[model samples]
Target: MLTSIQNPLVQKFRRLQNAKERRETQLFLLEGTHLIQEACAVNYPLMTVCYTSKWEEHHPELRSIVLENCDRVELVSDEVIKSIATTVNPDGIVAIAPRLAQKKPPIPAKLTIVLSTIQDPGNLGTIIRTAAAAGADGLWVSQDSVDLDNPKVLRASAGQWFRLAMGVSDNLHELVTSYQQQGVQIVSTTSHTQTSYWDVNLTKPTLILLGNEGAGLSDDLAALADLQVKIPMETGVESLNVATAAALMLYEVRRQRS
Candidate 1:
């Protein structure tokens, strides 16, 4: 069993915790058995898997499946697993997988989500999960948004990230302009808008723009939108959480399409 935390492979796994390191190495850490299973289900290649004997015994079938697919598997001590994992409870296993490639799909689909400067990893991941569930064709995030590969994002996504087609846009203005030229309507969400979200015709090809949590959409982005919409709430309530707002907007599209 790999007991020493100083082991070369263990140290390498530890380095993956850093965003810059993950970017440079093109690898990220995935914790817990469920995530490993999800990766395997999607045929996501895992370079290595580190597990403890207790985990192996409890999940013999899963362990065998992981061993069959992974390039290498190591029997490590619980302490070693904890050292590389970001979670309080490592759940006795961790796997390393390549970063999802940023391949923009040709012909952006009818329904798309454009996220601008979403700071919270949980919010980002939740949006991804909701988008996938709502049948959004793809998700486009602005360059300034949270790193998609963050562990918290991955965990919060509940494995939906692997299924979603997502890419980061370096120039959101240019992207919106291109979409608009193609006859795709850009819909922006904000409280100041008089138009209720339900009134908009989401049946057509649409790109829904969501902004940062504290600050709403940037003025430039808001100005470029084909329509600005707001979800009507009670008198005292100010606004909804970004993720909650996204769910409402996306499901409206789904409802319209259905």
Candidate 2:
């Protein structure tokens, strides 16, 4: 068993924790049996898996599956697993998987989610999970947003990240403009807007634009939107959390299309 944290393989896995290394190697660490299983189930390319003996004993079926599908499986000490894991208490398994390629599929007839400058990884991940659950066609994030591959983001997504088509764009305005050219309506959310979100015709091909946690959509992007709407709130409550707001908006689109 690999007992030392300095083992070459363990070092490689540890290096994957850094954003720059992840970008350079095109690899990231996925901890916990569920996340690793989700990746393997989707046939996402897995480079290596490290697990402790106790983990293998408790999850023999999963161990066999990992051994069968993965090219490399190392039996490591629990300490080694802990060293490589980002969580306070890991589930005794971690896998190294290649980063997902950014995809820009043809905009679907359904609603798309446009995220601008969303800095919180948990928020971004929860939004992604919500988007996938709501059957969003795709998701686009501005370049300034949190890294979709951030470990917290991955964990918050609850494996739904694998099921979604997502892309990052340096120019959100241009991206939204192109969608508009293709006859998709841009819907921006703001408190000052008089239009209620429910009033918008979401049955049409639409892109729902949500902005940063602190600042809402930039004025330029809001101005470019075909419609600006707001969710009606009780007095003294200004707004909802971005992810909650996204879920409400996306499901409303689904309700309309149904």
Candidate 3:
């Protein structure tokens, strides 16, 4: 077992926590048993896996699977696991996987959530989970948004991160325009809009545009929307959280199509 924190592999895993290191190396860490299981379920390539003897003892079947599938596996000490993981109390398992190669934007089928400058990792993760649950076809995030592979975002996704098809767009306005050309309706949300979210026909191929938590949508991006809709709120309420609004809007599409 790898017990020493000074080991080269342990140090490499610890370095992955930094965004710059992750970007340069094209590898990210997946902490906890659940994220590792989720990664296995999707057959996400596991480059290296470190787990404590206690974890292996309790999860023999999972260990067997990991041994069979992962490229490299190691038994590590608790201190080593803690050093490599971001969680306050890790479940004694973590993994490393290569960042996905750039792919074409998801085709706007039934629903696609288009986000611009969403900075919060938790909010983005929640939105991803909700979109997958609501049967949305895919997700498109602005390049300026939080990194999709942020450890917090991955954990908050509860494994849905692997199941969902997502892409980051360099130019959101142009991407929206492309979707519009394909006859996909672009919908934007705002407090000022008179049109209620439910009034729109979400059953058609659509792209739902959301924006930053505090700033909301950029004016030029908002102008690309074929329709502007609002979620009804109590008089005292100024706005809803970006993730909550995403859940409401996505489920509304699910509700309409059902």
Candidate 4:
């Protein structure tokens, strides 16, 4: 039973909570008994596991995974576990998970979701989760987008990242161009465009581009969109959250395709 709160392992966890440290180290903290179990279930390659005194008793699956496959396990005090988490409730356990390489797009001809420089980890994770749910062929994570392994992203995604085929690339334009050549229509969401999203034909091949929350779309990406579209909104609101916009566009496309 590790009683001290100032252990070296605890300090490392504390450091990784910072955005700068996470970026520098390319690692994020995942806190939750089930999340740890999910990672092990998917063979996500756990580097370290830290938990309070009762972790093993509380979660047999986690204990089994840790004892059988994990490289290291550090037992710490409940107070120590709380110090390293970003959430209000720490769940008495946390793990340092290595960032897995995202899979490349499987079928370039199918519906593709392209996210450009989306800085919010929560939005990016939610988009990925939505993409997985919407049955998109694959997803693109632009270089400027938030770190996929960031704790907030992992928590928001709810383990969807393990199943979806995703890629981190800087050449979204090139991919869009290639898909276009193959008869795929690239649709970019924009508040400026007048075309109703439903009217567009999404039954054919498509690539949907979502831009930053404040900035709708980059000029280059927007130029590539075969048709720029807008989700008709009530008068009070000018636009939707980028994730919301993407979800709306994805739903419209799916509705038309069916």
Candidate 5:
């Protein structure tokens, strides 16, 4: 049992709290039994783990995961485990998982989702989750989007980030424009658009551009869209909530393609 607060591994796990540390070490922390099971199920290369004794009794699957897959496991005191976990009740387990390298070469898929400056963690996470479910092959979030590793976002995503080969780009315009030039049809979601979303050919190489809650897509981003699509709404409602709109469009796209 690695019970001491002064232990070197404990310090190492604490370092994972920072984005710089996670990127530099290629490691991000996954707290709780659900996420731990997710990591093990995906065969994510987990470096280390720590769990409270009580969690072992309460969650047998987590115990099996810790014993079978964790490279190293320490019987940590609850206080020690809590120090590194992000949630209020962390289910008494934390895993250090290495970030997989993004694949090179363009992903050959007709469907993609481009997120621009999406600030809300829950909305961003939900969109990505929906995109994955919709069979989107590439999901690129602009530089300013919320970090996928943020614990709030992780909870919303339900561990989909580990399963999806999503990308992050520093230049939103260049990336979007480049895709537009590549015979790709860029679609923007908007409140007032000439074309209805139902008219879009989702089976083609397409990138759905989404923006921050307040701002919508930037003027430049909007201009780059081959066409903008808006969901139809009833009498009083002006538009769908961002996450709701995203789910409708993405699944509509899936229906169109499938």
Candidate 6:
């Protein structure tokens, strides 16, 4: 068993914790047995997997599967696993997988989410999970937002990240404009808007626009929306959490089409 944190492979896994290393390598770490199982379910390629001896003993079936599929599998000491993992108390298994490449000629999804400057990893992951559950077609995140492959985002997604079709947009305006040209309605939400979210005809091809948590959508992006609607709230509320607002809007679309 690899016991030393100084082991080359263990050190390499440790480097994956940084965003820069992840970007340069085009690989990210998947912590816990659940995330690995989820990846395997989708046939996501795994380069390497490491686990404590205790973990391997408890997960015999999973060990066999990974042994067959992964290019390399290592039995490491718990201390080494802890050093390589981001979580304080990891579930004892981790895998390294290459980043999902963007789909060229983006899928012409009927209900796509467009997010700008969404910095919170947890919120982004929650939105992804909700979008997948609500049957939204896909999602487009601004390139400047939190890395879609952030470890927290992955864990928060509960593995829906693999199932959902997503891409990053460097120029959101161009993306929104293109969608509009295709006859897709661009929807935005704001407290200032009078139109209720339910009143919007979301059955048509649509792109839902969400913004940063603190500042909200940029005025230029908001102005591009074909429709601006509001979630009805009590008198004193300023706004909703981005993820909560996303759930309301996505499900509203689901409700309208159902």
Per-model TM values vs. the true structure: 0.96, 0.96, 0.97, 0.91, 0.89, 0.97
Off by over 4 Å in 6: 102-107
Question: Over 4 Å off in model 2, which ranges?
Answer: none
Clashes in model 5: which pairs?
A: none
Instruction: Give the number of colliding residue pairs in candidate 6.
Output: 0
Candidates in descending lDDT order: 6, 3, 1, 2, 4, 5
Cα lDDT computed for each candidate against the true fold? 0.90, 0.88, 0.91, 0.81, 0.79, 0.91
How far out, in Å, is residue 175 in model 6?
0.6
lDDT for predicted candidate 5 compared with the true structure: 0.79
Indicate the worst ten consecutive residues by lDDT in candidate 3: 101-110
Please list the residue runs of candidate 1 whose C-alpha ends up more than 4 Å from where it truly belongs after superposition: 102-106
lDDT of each residue in 169-190, candidate 1, tens digit only: 8988988888888888999987
| Model 2, residue 22: C-alpha shift (Å) | 1.1
List of clashing residue pairs for candidate 6:
none
| Clash pairs, model 4 backbone | none
lDDT of 6 by residue, 97-136 (tens): 9986845334456899999999999999999999999998
- lDDT value, residue 6 of candidate 3: 99
User: In model 3, what is the error at residue 40, expressed in angstroms?
Assistant: 1.1
Candidate 6 TM-score, true structure as reference: 0.97
For candidate 6, give the lDDT of residue 119.
Answer: 97
What are the per-residue Cα lDDT tens digits for candidate 2 across 8-101? 8999989988988998988888888878878878877777999999899999988888888888999999899999999999989998987767
Clashes of 2: 0
Badly placed stretches (over 4 Å) of model 5 are 4-6, 60-62, 104-108, 234-239
Tens digits of per-residue lDDT for model 5 on 157-246? 787766776788899899888887888888888877667888878778877888877778889889898878888877798666678878
